[model samples]
Target: MTTTRSLVVPLPDTTATCQARRRLDELVKPVGSLGRLEELAAWLCGAHGTVPPRPLDDVRVAVFAGDHGVSAAPPGAPGVSAYPRELTAAMVRVFQAGTSGVTVLAREVGARVRVLDIAVDAELDDVARDVVARKVRRGSGAIDVEDALTPGEAEQAFSVGRAVADEEVDAGADLLIPGDMGIGNSTVAAALVGASLGLPAHRVVGTGTGVDETGHAHKVAVVERALHRVEGRVADPFDRLTALGSACAAATAGFLVQAAVRSTPVVLDGVFSLAAALVARDIAPDAARWWLAGHRSTEPAQSVALTALGLEPILDLGLRLGEGSGAVQAVPVLRAARAVLADMGSLADLT
Candidate 1:
């Protein structure tokens, strides 16, 4: 992540984290018997400033949908995705219809899904106002040849994300998940992370959406071109985002920044979310304390980014599908952490 202005994001409550660990150890079970569950519980405690974090009663996921210019080519071409570009808009409608994979999984975990059209190529005016109200442009520019977004569009996307986080937190969402929905967004994510971490294009590219070896190589070449375009020129996180990230990525980064400012805990989803998180962390170093690496994707760039942020994945399910599915899958595990802290009996209870 590029070093920028460190926002006044506060660290989690240390007293609460200590109390939570002590309480967990004093439980009726053996010390540390719960393994990582205890660690998750303690992190939640620090996030909420309480020994027993309030149950994750309200979980909200904001999927930022946009289209990439690099993906303008058809399938099997450089910078293009296996899926068609129309899938971005089609998936938005599917998400609103509650029939998407993420929606169904969200239902099982008692979480809510909200889709935002940040830079979708099509006019989603027919969708809910809340979703399309923040559209900065139709689609982002081809990063391989031009900046992904203009300076104005990048700023607007970031503002939209910050506003959405406030709206969710004000609506009583205790936990937030930022997901991505854009064709070829994986390429955009990799390019941004490659720029942020000063890595070569080959090191950051990954086969998103089940690409074959040839397709993966094509993606790598495309990302390499984009990274070369901005190498040694953009050092600020925001500048890197404008150079290499999609509209949805900038929005996700903004959403992450505001969540930390609001002291809301977040479960990061996939390479897309982690890519944004790396940028967000650069803007606010302390914001890392409020985020949990929801799951690890198969992307090599994701592991590198997560390690750079000092976050360990809660689950390594080999999940690559974005739209916050993996993060929501780990929500039940977090809920269990709260349950263990709130319901598991202690020796005092036995007495």
Candidate 2:
């Protein structure tokens, strides 16, 4: 009973992929000497439907920021997250200011960043107008005891994601990266993966933000409770999203789906993006074809979701940062792959 949507996700271009493989075989280096780089080049060629794959000059990293109610607690009391809830909005401002790690990394890779205020609890008055214009609500309800978003809000966030993809693609974004920003997003993201894979809380939960053993146990209990509440609707992707995920996650799902639909490639960050992409893949069927797991995350849910998607991460830096920093780090790897395909000397050149 997955959330069946009216959408058609196209497969990658086999002709271009085969062409890339053939050309890769002719590279002056030993056959397959480039190893995964060869595979990556072929993937790029397939995704772009071009023999050598076009340059990824206009890479856009979209950070979806939102607040999760599961992070709420009584005054002076702690909750699922180690950081204060207000940091979500603060980081959004940091992203807009172009000072965060994500911004720095994106700039180094010849890309740009866009920060969207999907559901941060704060007013974010200091942030740029365009950054906060897409707020879905003040924050999501606590998934441990209440629904994260209403049906309408879930759809709205998803639609916002699709619109963002369309906006970026229409504006000539050759590649897209969807990042996550929230205090307790890892918890919700793990829950999304659990629902998609029918796993228990212990199997899905992880030590997000270096929570202590006590904090880890509490987080597991909280996710367990949330899973219990959604047991009946686990089969419905949107229902699971509405009950256990946040506006950011839903928007990410939409963003990934629309990127695939538009035949644009995407680099997924960590577990946050993985969970959302899991739901996106379920809804759109073959959307995973347009994605690359940017890096391996410390979270087990990240590996779980990657395995489910049949995607192998490009890097394994143990990055737990969720601001799309990990994916941005892989931009250079993509550049290297594209370089080998576009610039490397071929055996035919020697002839």
Candidate 3:
């Protein structure tokens, strides 16, 4: 498959960022008093190429849904996911009904939600008419034994993501949030992060979806085996993604790259999204400029990925849910930062 080098992502303008900082310093409040809020506003100025960045009025969250072949493990299997693969399709329905955590939070933040069925295994019934139907395959192959997708399939998944990002941008979405909802995705995410950072599985794996102690141990072992299979072979980001073997993650990474190409800011959620971000960064180093770590997840790999990317989470609520819940929670903070920059009077005006 071709790498993302062909895609041109513009770097944030440092001159505009400096101007934004200067303007913030002149606000009525004390210099640096707003803490991270001031920093976020300046970063927005750099991203949007405006001294006073526009408010994130039209935020959109795109939740990519898929299934993992590993999720089909037998009942007595050692490394089976806690939830059934059927939940992947069921949750997509929930998202469409506007009753899922992501929908509720999107409503609270005034952001629109789009559920993209990138590669769910089962045929979904009663799905909303608007859900993007870009299924690459029934699901990804088992990563522990074989590559998740052939080179062509991997590229197709990336195209699905890029198309979705383009569509959203065309619809006037200024800010983007990428989310994941696939059974066994956390296991795939842990393996991807562990392999990319050269960390052991025990260090990066976490108890996903309330797995028991035995299930957690099994998960770690599964990750270990998968990483061992792909170790020393993941010379590039695309290789790492194929090694990890997740369609949803590949799509999310693609979406992230496309959003950055469009100069749209992204708030990434949890380990799955962070794992994709790691791959996206490898594909396009400057893509990191348009992303913010929405929240720190309980999963250990999240910290590893965020630290490697030089991003600090805006919120740390011990959130482990992956339906973009944590990222949506941080939207208000971005809004508040933009509001401060746009609405606050200058010290000269106050005097």
CA lDDT for candidate 2:
0.90
Model 3 segments more than 4 A misplaced: 1-6, 76-80, 128-132
Q: lDDT (CA) for every model shown?
A: 0.88, 0.90, 0.87
Every candidate's CA RMSD: 2.4, 1.9, 1.6
Worst 10 residues of 2 by lDDT: 1-10
Could you tell me the TM-score of candidate 3? 0.96
For each candidate in turn, the TM-score is 0.96, 0.96, 0.96
Find the number of clashing residue pairs for candidate 2: 0
Q: Compute the lDDT for candidate 3.
A: 0.87
lDDT by residue (tens digit), candidate 2, 115-214: 9999999887677887778999989999989999987787888989998999999999999999888999899988898889988899988998888887
List the pairs of residues colliding in candidate 3: none
Better of 1 and 3 by lDDT: 1
lDDT digits (tens) for residues 1-351 of candidate 3 = 563546899898899899999999999989999999999999989998997888789999999999887767676765556788899999998998899998998899899998988889877745854554577778888888888877777667887788899899999998999988999988889888988889999989898787888989878888888899988998787777776757788889999999999989999999999999988888888889999999999999899999999999999999998889999999989888988889999999966
The per-residue C-alpha lDDT of model 2 at residue 232 equals 78
For model 1, residues 259-311, the per-residue Cα lDDT tens digits are 99899999998999999999888777788889999899999889999999988
